[model samples]
Target: MAKLIVSKFGGTSMGDAECMLRSSEVAFGRGASLVVVSATSGTTNDLIALGKASESQPWAEAEKILSKIHSRHVKIAADLHLPTESMQRLETLFEEMGSIAKGINLLKDCSVKAMDTLMSLGERMSSVLCTEAMAQVLKRHNSDKKAMWFDVREVLRTDDSFGKARPLTKEVESLSQKKLGFLRDYKTVVVTQGYIGSTEEGMTTTLGRGGSDYSAAILAEGVAADVLEIWTDVAGIATTDPRICPAAKPIDEISFKEASELATFGAKVLHPATLLPAIRKNIPVFVGSSFDADAKGTWIRKEVEDHPLIRAMAMRKKQILVTLSTPEMLHAHGFLFQIFKIFNDHKVSIDAITTSEISVSVTLDDSTLVNKKLIADLSEIADVQVEENLTLISLIGNNINHTPGLAKQIFETISDINVRMICLGASKHNFCFLVSEDQSTQAIQRLHKKFVEA
Candidate 1:
């Protein structure tokens, strides 16, 4: 039996008519029975802007943004020469979007729930166009395979989180087996939208930014696919971000643990949560460029031949360090729990953390710091200091905590830099530290040269 492959293409891969055609060809050539695609390039951001404008701007202004969005999809549809049915579907979606914008403008309110519904139009429209593209590719190949557009919301069930919903895994698995199991016959190519799912109450919800990959992984696991392919703009995973370190090289293969650490730390190729399902099911994942399908892509698996001490390094910028200090924390067991519970209540995730008897310091994404209520809650128990303009740098590899002299070598390389916080021993795959944002580039370059290049 042929290996079952579920392929996901990023925004740029579906940017325009040509991009969609190329991505369709890649999917077909790779024998992807199910293809998951993101919104066209920049469409999600445009929808977000439309949502904000609808809430604050004049009706005319919101209309203009909506017109722009409509024109984008119309042009792609025209280029692909989509069927009348598909074009009508696109028009109906645009009508719904316009109505939503009008309502939000009149109400002067764009709740997270409304924003999710508005943003979901991006993927919904792209899936229509991509389905036509897939049909054209199948016709061109003169194959008997039928191309079908599948509504992922039919199978991908999530909680009612609206803006960042979590998938209901068991439901997804059962639904996939019942609804998508026909793909096992190898006679149909199913095109589906990613990043968007329906709540148990049937309300539309999104999986947050860069969630397309995560959704694809979830579906792959649900169907028990043999492989998951993530096709993006880049060729594959690199030793380091090429824009930051020009000397960065491509990684042909990587272990799931190291890839997870790299993504959590800041590698943009894969979303931090994308590998979770794949890891649980031990499914191999492929990361490659849809623009250059022939390129050697990176493969992520449970094990690899090489287990280097330092595989790759990542840098996450615009981090905020929150330090909570109080005499109450000294020899206290529940104090840390209280601090963490406050963050949990606010739904803010802490990245790297270090603690002392009297003080606990943690790193968080700069965006999450906008919740003043969280700070206020913490301030009631301890003195809280928020430090911005910080960057978290992580080294992802094997046995990071077990390797002696690793920290010494790293510090020796960047002895001049002031390390604000250090988090280690938590995971053997990662050793992360914080530094000033301005010195992040220099620090990463030096470390890459000393460790990766050498």
Candidate 2:
């Protein structure tokens, strides 16, 4: 309703009690921060792991599993001396999570729909903790503390699609305006979570991986927030994976389009879908470090200076390449229709696709959950091969297009490494290639040294 500042902190940003304190400090450092947080360290995985393990057995076993996870947060609150009301809400959340786990166990099958409902607790629990922590720390340090635990589940609505649900925009906007309807009524801080949402029927849902960042963006857009600060573990988006490209430098600023490209390519710092809402609203999103609040980090915006090509590099290791070779693809019109229809029926998303004479090669994220039954259908028209454990390296930048020797420079650097496949003219500004998972890190290092570093 008002120009609020919505900040989203990742798991690493709120990894512990200390990180939570630092997140609040970062919030206060910038006035009127609306903080959104992921689960406290390892909470999501713990919850999911329990959900999977509990499906085969009695509900009580699953109930105990979740009780352990709940106690960890309880201990942190006890250590911090959280106020009465917040702590009581947390107790209520644990009860809900426990009940949900039992339900999953009774169901015996953890469908994506079921999993989404079970896993919403990650954000729900963390929001309660973060809100309480913010209240205590801000009251103590900033001396002008005003914070509330905001329920995004009440506002960030989505379909009942479970693991990878699309946001229900109209409902979410209306609910957000109503729930956060008050920021215009007053100046305050609100803490919430990323990733999870609820349906109109009150069913719990998750907005895919990195959904929390998207949540932050949507809230910023809804409240007409001045800025969205995304707190993470790294030094903003990098030129390359620092693990591979040691010379990779932090980007001071990048465009939303560029940020989306980076997320698609390999920059795990921001979710691929997070930028659209911010871009639509023309709100600036800042990615900063949770450890050092003063770091300039990176700002994703609408404009950029005369920056160099290849702003960053992103690599993903878990992949499978399905190369379709058939004569029908050579001169066929909309032959792609047949190829896509098979994937669509199976609900598989092709991460990267390239076509040529008599062949179409697709790189799919491993989590698309493909199986041999679907492959049998594809083998009808084309020869199918599944290249497992490959890594995708995407060179990302605005001016990445129409570079004459850029491809040459890249290949020359990795001339010796066995490159599996390469795709250029990748959209407006990316050139991606698939390499052996083993060589991914080395290939990135070599590319950075040759093209990026002095």
Candidate 3:
């Protein structure tokens, strides 16, 4: 068995022709490797827009957008020195994508089915192009130019859940081994698509937000890869979002548990759910800067020690805080239960929540589908208000069961800020607070200063 590494190249790595070439160089530079690639920068978003626009109004504009997309990819292929045959093939794929977009426009309502089919074009095109480019580079180096680009739609099986498809884990796990075994038949590299999988019925599906990272993790876990490198635009995982805290430094390593906490809260580096499959397989994931691949990156392991009480931070902005107040909830069995049932039925997840003697407040993503039926039921005895224009900032660390008056210190640090509400997690390692959107950056900087920096 050959040692394998699955490098999950982010959008920045495959952003354009130059980025794609540089990534090809890094592949051989970093040693024996397989690669998973996301779409070129902004491709997925463009596809999503095309879908929405087509749904509302399928117009001639779809053709204009399609032409624009085709020109970009064709230009990139030309710049990359891809063989004429490969360039033509890449163009054909884009044409197919364009066709789908136009179909959505004509349909005047892009179904989840159509959206999944459309969104996948981003990764599919990138991998195909990157594979061709890598093949040319390897040929120049006297290395084998026989890399096979596997379409994930053929193997990555999942449910028919439309946009957010859940994989048939056991099925995929078995298939992964089989596929890798077949892929290893060639001594060259294997380039695969990220962020897109297929349903049992052979329809395209996505793993929700950050699906590309999740795709990488699943592939790594499936192959038992020695390393799963997540190459992005940044150096690595930072102590805090530098955009919010300029002093934030890159972390060299993090435990899976810690990484999970940070990702879930707001690290914004890895998809929060991306770590689960990796953790289950005890796979080590590396987060590194694509622009500077030589730098020491962050490593995530299954079990770890020596984490800071305030290791890293994150935030979910533009959240809605819902407060339900009623005397009926106090000492009334199943009152709060019914409220949650409503939320559960609607599929809106609660991030942080607090309960009082007569009221229950929860922070959610403000999905439009929150059921009116549940609201009507709650209205029978409770008052409800949806508070928008708020942000929830959280600090995730390890063994924070007690933080030496951390609550008091946090309040004192950002006391002048507009503090709307706060909730410390039961584990005590994480403390979350609500504040005005305008003060979010300042509040984060303040907490970063007094607590983290000297």
State the weakest 10-residue window (summed lDDT) of model 1. Answer: 328-337
In order, what lDDT does every prediction score? 0.95, 0.80, 0.80
Please provide, for model 3 over 23-67, each residue's C-alpha lDDT reduced to its tens digit, 9 standing for 90 to 100: 887776665357899989988887877777776754666666667
Tens digits of lDDT, candidate 2, 46-82: 8888788778877666767777787888877777677
> What is candidate 1's local distance difference test score?
0.95
Which candidate tops TM-score? 1
lDDT assessment of candidate 2: 0.80
lDDT tens digits, residue span 1-454, model 1? 7989999999999999999999999999999999999999999999999999999998888888888999899999999998999999999999989988988998999999999999999999999999999999999999899999999999999999889999999999999999999988999999999999998788999999999999999999999999999999999999899999999999999999999999999999999999999999999999999999999999999989999999999999999999999998887789989998999999999899998989999999998777889989999999999999999999999998999999999999999999999999999999999999999999999999999999
Rank by lDDT (best first): 1, 2, 3
| TM-score of every prediction relative to native | 0.99, 0.94, 0.94
Tell me how far the alpha carbon of residue 245 in candidate 2 is from the true structure, in angstroms, after superposition: 2.6
Better candidate number, 1 or 2, judged by TM-score: 1
lDDT of 1 at 63: 82
Clashing pairs in 1: none
